[model samples]
Target: MTPLITDPLQPVFVIAGAAFCVCLMATICSPALTLFSQILASAQKKVFYDKFARQLATMATTLGVLCFTTMAAGILHTALEEPALFEGPLRLPLMAALGTLTLAFALQVIYSLTWNSLKKNKALHRLFGLFAGLSMFTAVFLSLGLKRTVLAAGLSIPSSAPALDTFLAVYSIPAQSVFWPLLAQALLAGTGAAGALGLCYLLLRREADNYGRDYYNFSTAYCARCALIPSLLQTIPAALLLWMSQPVLSPFALENPFVLLWAAGIAIPLLACAGWMIVAVSAAPLRHKPAMITAPVLLVAGYAVQMFAALRVYALI
Candidate 1:
């Protein structure tokens, strides 16, 4: 029932963590969408490559830089505030997380900047984008594992091992029960958020760019499906995550109205957003403008609430 974070700087850390999550998800999704667009273009499909995919790549680079900076700043802040967290068993995993993120950011920038030059080498260019996404996903897994190791009690870190074995041990931590569900939940949520954001971006630009009705309609439908499918699929992992945390949360469940409210805050808006997106995709082109606009707003709001609630629960645990 009591608040977990009493520190005066707790608010600042929460804001920073939220910002990092948003930026990281956007970064991951942008590159993935870019790869999807490129595949469509390569197949001689009717995609607007320059306006849609290239723009997504650019956004990916920008968001990657932002995500990297935010993560670095967070690590530095943590090191300053709690130096012991970086000591002993925790050090290697944290380092690996940062190193992987750095690699992802570098690859993302190259992929974006070389898009034009790589026209003749589409395969290699796609590889760069692919690796960048993979790296980001890996980083997320490592970071999540490290977070669980830090928070959960009675997690043992192998000691007195050789350097290589130690590194492997740290990397393998996510395979344990505590971290995998969180990683799955994050990937699903990030994919859904990316799709929702893409839908909003397309809607905002559709008027000014005035791509033909057919193209605009296709793009809208694409983004809508992207947003809807993963979101619906996310429920399984979400339930698993909640189940995993029940031990920590059960004592307060009945006493805490806010917990239930936050849960509703996450689920209701996203379900409504998914319903609206269905309407947008099914209705006549641009006829359901309100649905198109409202879906993304609700999606983002739901995600924000979910992130806030998850952070609070993690702190409590």
Candidate 2:
């Protein structure tokens, strides 16, 4: 008999499979959904963000489906093989992560639907981002810790050629040796955490400064939906890198430290730069046409790359 989550590879694989479906759904429907929402609100005569309430609603529905699938698989894993999976210290954290993720996604769905209805509720919007950040942070810690514990235990060692294949079959991702550069990754996390907090400040600043006006300039629905995309985008990469590097604490993909120097040292910083560019572009007076087009294009491209990387690492591609 298989130990539900005991087959560490199995549960991760299940999660990845569900995520694959979500990616397809997001890619195929997100644009269409956004367009539909705009059409529905054509008569609203609101700002661009306000008019996107329906788009957020659509995003919430799609993401809700994704989160539900993930939770269902996790619950089933826990329920079917409770004794094996629940006997250890890791059990509680695992369950906690799953539950939080479920609640976050569920709230996301509701938040998405009612953003327009709750447009003035800045406090609530901040709470949503708070929960989202909490969820991602907890998830990163627990899931990566669990994966590290398993790897260190030598429970899933390979003894054959095609080592990458062996690793994926048992670990549910491509072979990634990551135990050496722990400090760098930790620094990355620190940077990322700061960036995350900075974004939260950006989101909340409008409300805090505005006397009685809405804190979030956008409709509640649109803001809620928009909130999710960034959270999910950041979490997935962070989780994956964290998981991959647990074994050795180094960059997972590149063998040469120099290579890592470029990937983590250079690429990540560039991505950060790009993020700030978007922020500044969004706030620019007059909103230059080049910035307008470049910002969204960059964001969409970045998200697409992140999603594709997730799929590949998880072997969903």
Candidate 3:
């Protein structure tokens, strides 16, 4: 087997998968982000939730569209390369994932286009985002299920288990228990990125006298609180994934196809550091520390996780 990792077109997989990862994060976080932005008032802060919502919607929609198209192409290419990979019972799950993705794209487009025009109808706009978010969540849940099954197929696990039993067997019981939390990791990553960036913007606004220190502090604490628990809880699912997938993945390479695991290792601590600084800066009343120190680290590490996960999904080095 030629290492698919080294294929010339692997970069295409990287780019497409990277975009898709962002799409997943954005889609999952869109509703919360939109609502969070709305709760923040310009009078009390330097940012306008509607403006932030617009930017987020634009990003999510554009990426969602690209992901929808690119994944379609990528799937076709991979299926053609290895027809058996998609045959038998596997097609059902893959098709479900694809169908979910296609529907998400349409919802995203409609949501994005209506952003400006639907200013008066905030409820409907939010409704679109909410549906899209749920759809995106469903799509990702199905996709993760598919990845486990794919790994099982790649490892050629032999068993007399029922059709779906092979998948459950490969993915693991304890690991599956943390399914929603594992999924929430993406949401945490998304919120961390948005909150950290928004914090920076607000800090800059404070220096510019556009926003008050109190508002900045409040917002910092708010964002940190939103991300901290999920970041902490992610350790469970991360460990589960590493443990469960190791036996299946170890045969594929020498020492390193688990870049996603490595990235998660780096991120978990950075997230802790960032969370602490954010707390000191925003949550701590006695003494506020410099949040700027850890914020960038968190963003970079979070992005690394996202990037590594994309690479793993595409089997790209």
Leading candidate by lDDT: 1
Pick by TM-score: which candidate is best? 1
* Candidate models: Cα lDDT each: 0.68, 0.41, 0.57
TM-score of 2: 0.41
Which residue pairs in candidate 1 collide?
none
Question: Candidate 3: TM-score?
Answer: 0.60
Q: What local lDDT score does residue 75 receive in model 3, on the 0 to 100 scale?
A: 83
RMSD of each: 3.7, 13.5, 7.5
| Per-residue lDDT of candidate 1, residues 1-317 (tens digit) | 55645676765665555546655777775677778778887687555754567666765676667666766787789899999766765677778888887888888899999888998898999999899889888888887766766666676765555646666665566344746766776787677667666666777666777887877676666666766777677766766666666665655474664466456645854664556466555856456667666665565556555555666776641
Model 3: which ten-residue window has the lowest total lDDT? 280-289
lDDT of 3 by residue, 106-135 (tens): 887787798779878877887887787777
Of 1 and 2, which scores higher on TM-score?
1
Q: What is the Å distance of residue 94 in model 2 from its true position?
A: 1.8
Q: Decide which is better by TM-score, 1 or 3.
A: 1
Off by over 4 Å in 3: 1-24, 39-47, 83-87, 153-181, 194-233, 239-317
